[model samples]
Target: MLIQKVRFERSPKLHAMMTEAPYPVNARVVVQGKRGPEVATVRDEAEPMPGDGRYGMILGAASEADLDRWAELGREAEDLKWLLRARARARGLPVKIVAAEFTLDGSLLTVSYSAEERIELGALIQDLRGHTRARINFAAVGPREQAMMLGTLGACGRENCSSHHLQDFAPVSIRMARDQQLPLNPEKLSGPCGRLLCCLQFEHTQYLDLLKDVPRKNARVCHDSSGACGKVVKLHPLEGTVDVLTDAGMMQGVPASELRVLKGEPAPGQQKNRPRD
Candidate 1:
């Protein structure tokens, strides 16, 4: 009934597994993963989770021999990765092999790759099968997943969130950048993956909440300090301020709290003429 979080060396995801006894954090344990018996590190202390049938039980604590074998497998996988790349190049296939992982039992080998378009791997898989006795599987990943697997730094000069802590990619769109009033320049708004920055979703809600109280751009408002009506030129949601063009043709930075939105007023540069009867 005790559940613990564990992470595999080849994956960034945290998987829950049943533990027979308590294990300290960072302790190595062997578990039956989807691929096969694999070594995983204990991410946290075990906790009770009743009726948890989704996870499999941990085989046992990893022995010194198991750790040694794990290291050997890592080196083998690296060699296999290079072999795969060389084979692809020989075949004239336009693909970048990102990673290769072998099951603990050495019965299965999984390879991940990225490409501009879909590619038929029939010949490549056949070639690899001939090179090794292990069953070979190839997976194609998108630009974001490729970047995550590569573990590259993002625009903020920090590790990519997908590689560091994010369990899965969130749906990011241009609306998030626009809501935050960011410049629409693609080069500036994109991450190393050439996609919309994932951090855009982090503070989008806060920006929306702040904008609720601020006047929209080019709206008519009255500055309480001078009782002068002006047209809002820009909004500073983060600072709670708005730049206004006063009726006297002067620009002023006024706090949002001091301005009252004047609805139904004529727009700037428009005349409010009397109607003839």
Candidate 2:
């Protein structure tokens, strides 16, 4: 029989699952992991996954005995997190324990936490070893990762996108905001992660394309029918309107289609850091 590949349903950072076989969704099964067999649900239909000898397999749907054992492990892991958190707090460690998970066989407890910066944990790990016979694994994550592991609400008045569905973060910069004519205020543009908002990347491409047909701010323009000239003061892209400072000393908003560029060289106040269209 041909062996097929499958991935267990769960966040890769929080729970590791991969390997071979075809299985139906919601089928509880145990796969031989590095430490021991662990319980995981058949997340979805199986698909092929290329591997270099680091894959685990689905032994089969979990038995009643296996389910009982998994429940016991969950309670134990919760207790472990509490203990570790108390100890770290007592030592004045700058860390927030997000979660703790036990290896299927109970040989190890993987503790996840977030820290502002790196700090020595050698002494703490050693102390944990002496306290618990089982080995402990420490995983450090950033603020966004912490929220994803734990969960958080965003300024958008909803559950954070990262925690709920944003699996991968893309690079965002001030340029994205500039391209969209958004206020460059950091507080308004940043997300709960203290980084640029993830949504900034969404409409950037549309803004870039819209800018091609728009004239830059302070560019000289004239009404084709009346031959009255003016310098562009502002542009409302979605409205298809342009505010112009007419040579007659009046500022008026007019349809973009009625205006033609008076100069072909360049517009004043056009900079990579400041583009108004």
Candidate 3:
């Protein structure tokens, strides 16, 4: 059914499935809970089945009946919100519960909330279980997930990364920033994930393509009779010009075609700079 494997909170091995999911590494699905139906975005997918012992769940596609049932239960989300708020206050816990969803069959209930510390939610779960006669699960998602769920305005004044269409969460390295010659500013480079933005990976291949024929910035080569040889400071691959700081105390731009790249160390007496004078 082209179901992708996904990861859920606490259940690292638990996977969710999606049908015709748009995002490359992400998808949105309706989770069926005992008390109500909830919507969740698929984080990871299981496909080709990685040999790794990672477990996954095929949260099969939601049927039309499931959608209608979820719509009916959505009306009760506000009531669930108020109940959760009152419970947290009674317990003297600083927490905020946003939304709640129940399964199509009203067998499961999932509550979405945010908090700083690990607050005990046993009483809350018990209350919900007793009243709804269904399984209650509380998921504490990070800011990244929060943004995905609630949506937000980004630095560009548009919708945040996940909402706009980012799928995979690849680990970005400082090496990538350096390669792109971007300033290492957390505010400038990081996304709602508080990590390097995933968009940086988009055009990286183009930069790599441009760099293949270019020489490193630290190449040394002899200049004319001036013996002006130093590290390469700049390179224009298309123009074939390489700017090098020479021993003569000046930066000279020379055509890359005119200079021979040294292999290992230059052989002695072959400086190519000593004139017959």
Candidate 4:
């Protein structure tokens, strides 16, 4: 598969694997760095990097040794975390060191953290470089990336999607919101990344399937009276009910059996509910 390096230019340098050869969902990558490397597998395929293409590097088909290096570095992730934290405090940088992971090849050491502003972390980088003898990178991860680094069980009682199965992060739109009829609350809609949840894409096909057979909301239908027409009110896909507004001057609740959909006309042929002349 086409592998990618997960380096946070504005954050840290963590190498990850793009699982698929050409890169598809949950594309796994082994992040390589000094102090050890990590395998930050992609839960989605790597897309073309936007803009100047300065996001991260890519490595093709790593070896077994590469994976071992990641495991070794993971062992000291906690210790390096402590060092970075102490260093940040002494340097008077208001930062929260979330987590740290080493690269698989020992070529780089990435420190993951979060902060309010872009704190000058040059000193911290220098310190880590000198101490670890590897390329030092300070990664400022957000809620989403943080969730990827420090994984935990999900609401479904399984590992978080980013940490386990999702390869690349896709753009979650308000369409998913409208489709689910969910409240337009950012907090409620967002996942660990502080963006729309990945699960929103799940079962989307099924929803589309249900909608396929249903008539359009604006569709017009005919009432029992051959001369009367009606406007579609609401649709019940599963129940096959098409509640309609009768064009007749008067209307009464009627079962769908008493109604026939109007065809071949923009407006209703018969007016069931209308004003008296």
lDDT of 3 by residue, 1-277 (tens): 2456444322323344434433345454564432334544566544554445433333455557756766776666557767888988988878878567665566666788888888888878876754677677897976566666666677778887665565644556665655565667889988775767766777666645554544556756765555567777775544656788876678888875556556763422342322111
Alpha carbon deviation, residue 244, candidate 2 (Å)? 3.4
Task: At residue 130, give the lDDT of candidate 2.
Answer: 64
lDDT string for model 4 (1-277, tens) is 3444454322333344333444433444444333443454444445544344233333444457756665677767667888888998988899989876655655666677898787788788776765677676777777767777677667567777877656666667766555444567888777766677878888655644454444444566676665567666554544545566666644434344556656653332233222111
Evaluate residue 16 in candidate 2 and report its C-alpha lDDT on the 0 to 100 scale: 33
Q: What's model 1's TM-score?
A: 0.90
Displacement of the residue 103 alpha carbon in candidate 3, Å = 2.3
Q: Residue 249 in model 2: shift from native, Å?
A: 4.9
Give the 10-residue window scoring lowest on summed lDDT in candidate 3.
Answer: 268-277
Of the two candidates 3 and 4, the one with more favorable lDDT, higher being better, is 3
A best-first ranking of the candidates according to their lDDT comes to: 1, 2, 3, 4
Query: Using TM-score as the measure, which candidate wins?
Result: 1
Provide the lowest-lDDT 10-residue window in model 2: 1-10
What value of lDDT does candidate 4 attain over all alpha carbons? 0.58
Q: Which residue pairs of candidate 1 clash?
A: none
Score candidate 2 by lDDT: 0.71
The lDDT values for all models are 0.82, 0.71, 0.61, 0.58
On TM-score, the stronger of 3 and 4 is 3
Tens digits of per-residue lDDT for model 2 on 1-277?
1133333322423233564457676667787766566777655566556445455566777889888987887787788788878888988998888888776677887778888778777767876776567788888877767666666677878877777666577788888887777778999998887888888897888776666666777788898887889888877766767788899999888887777876573432333344563
Please give each candidate's TM-score: 0.90, 0.76, 0.57, 0.55
Task: For candidate 3, report its TM-score.
Answer: 0.57
